[model samples]
Target: MDLLRKSIERVTPLTNEEWKLIVEKSKRIQLKKGEFLQTQHSFVVYECFVLTGSFKTYIMGENGTETVIFFTFGNEWICDLNAFYHKKQASYNIRALEDSELVVVTKPAKDVLFSKIPKLVNFHIHMIEKANIVLQQRVLDLMNKTSKERYVDFIEKNSGRLQKVNNKNLSSYLGISQEFLSKIKREGEVYNEKAR
Candidate 1:
């Protein structure tokens, strides 16, 4: 729990009592590659912090196409905010990209946490603010950026996590087709290699 303690300490220090309360409903779970953390119909009963490995959050279309929304690696939070905050079923899926470990907190426990640790509320606000900024940027990118530009942005942000994601999901996240992503990626890699 030291990692979680450190993550929480970024906003405020936690007392032994406070830490115990926060982790009361938390449990460590493992997900194998391709395992579903939350499916579209699953109840958003918990939110998790990634301890190891990665996951992709996405939605499936009517024709069975998957549109990836985002990826979360170690030290990141993964939750369906819409469903989690509203206490409803998930609208998308969170699937493990590789074997991953997570610390999950049940909604009931989190709902009660705010009252006991007000500092945690501030921490939550910071987390939401950061997540909101990323989401906003994604929307703007989809509206104003070209596919290659988006791919570049993705590389800048994702860095070490790219090799863990397959071409299909990466292209879906970039709002481009697999072939187009491959072309740009090849070109971008060559350009980077030449610069080096």
Candidate 2:
């Protein structure tokens, strides 16, 4: 709950009363690796704040292929925004990549909080803006960047995830074949060794 408070505080200061209200309304949940936090066809009733570990959100295609959309880590929020906002069923799945803890606020609880503390609305807006920017950048990268360029960009921007995330998942997220990703990684290692 303190972590949840800190994450909200990063966006807006909350009064003691507001903090108390939030703590009362949110619930803590734990999930192990391979667990599904939210699956397709379910209603997205809560928005989750990751307290520890990581998660991946993806959609399954008609051909049964899973396309990785994004990864959310500790200190980040994960939800099917459109479904949550529109009161529709989720079109994607969110699954735990590792053993994870999350603080979740239900839609009703969040609405009540917004009504009581209007300023907290800005915090949600800021989160949405950040998510949008990242989504846009990812779309652009996938469309315009070569596989190797995409891999390099991922290494530069998400170095912290390199060791935590497996090659298959990373390659899928980067829209590259696993074989190509391995080749790129091997070549990168060779280049670094020669530079040393």
Candidate 3:
């Protein structure tokens, strides 16, 4: 619960009463690896805070290929923003990449929170703003960055994720082939040797 408090504190500091109210509204959830947090077309009734573990939020193309859009790890919030905000079905699916624990707040509970705790509204805004910034950066990278450059950035941003996730999944997220990712990694080694 301290962690939850810290997560919220990143955006806004809550009063003791407000903190208690928020905590009372959240429920803990546990999921095994490969479990679906929210499937495509499902309504996102809750906002999830990752307590321990990682998740991938992705969309399947018409051809049945998964295109990952975001990764959520411990201390991060994960939800289909469109579904949660608009009260519509989700277009993306959120799946656990490992056995995970999450704290979830239902939409109505969150609404009550905002009404009762004004600072919480600021917290919500900050959350959405952070997600939007990340999404915009991803779009800019896809449009302007080279595959190798993007791969390098990905590795730097998610330093340990490559060790946890399969290469195929990483390749899909980078919009490159597994073989090409391998090649980029090898190229990095060669560049490192030259610099040394």
Best by TM-score: 2
Per-model C-alpha RMSD: 1.4, 1.2, 1.3
lDDT scores of the candidates, listed in order: 0.88, 0.88, 0.87
| Runs of candidate 3 exceeding 4 Å displacement | none
lDDT of 1 by residue, 25-117 (tens): 689999999999999878854688999999999999989989999999999888888788888889889999999999998777787898878
Q: For candidate 2, list the clashing residue pairs, or say none.
A: none
Instruction: Give all TM-scores, in the order shown.
Output: 0.94, 0.96, 0.94
lDDT, candidate 1, equals: 0.88
Q: Where does model 1 exceed 4 Å of error? A: none
Residue-level lDDT of model 2, residues 1-196, one tens digit each, is 7788898999999889989888888899999999999998898557999999899898888898888989888888888888888889997899899999999888888899899889999999999998899989989998998988988887887788776688878888888788988999999999999999
Looking at model 3, which ten-residue stretch has the lowest summed lDDT? 160-169
For each of the candidates, give the backbone clash count: 0, 0, 0
What's the true lDDT of residue 170 in model 2?
A: 86
Model 2 TM-score relative to the real fold: 0.96
CA-RMSD of model 1? 1.4
**Candidate 3 structure quality by residue, lDDT tens digits, 154-173:** 88988966666777778888
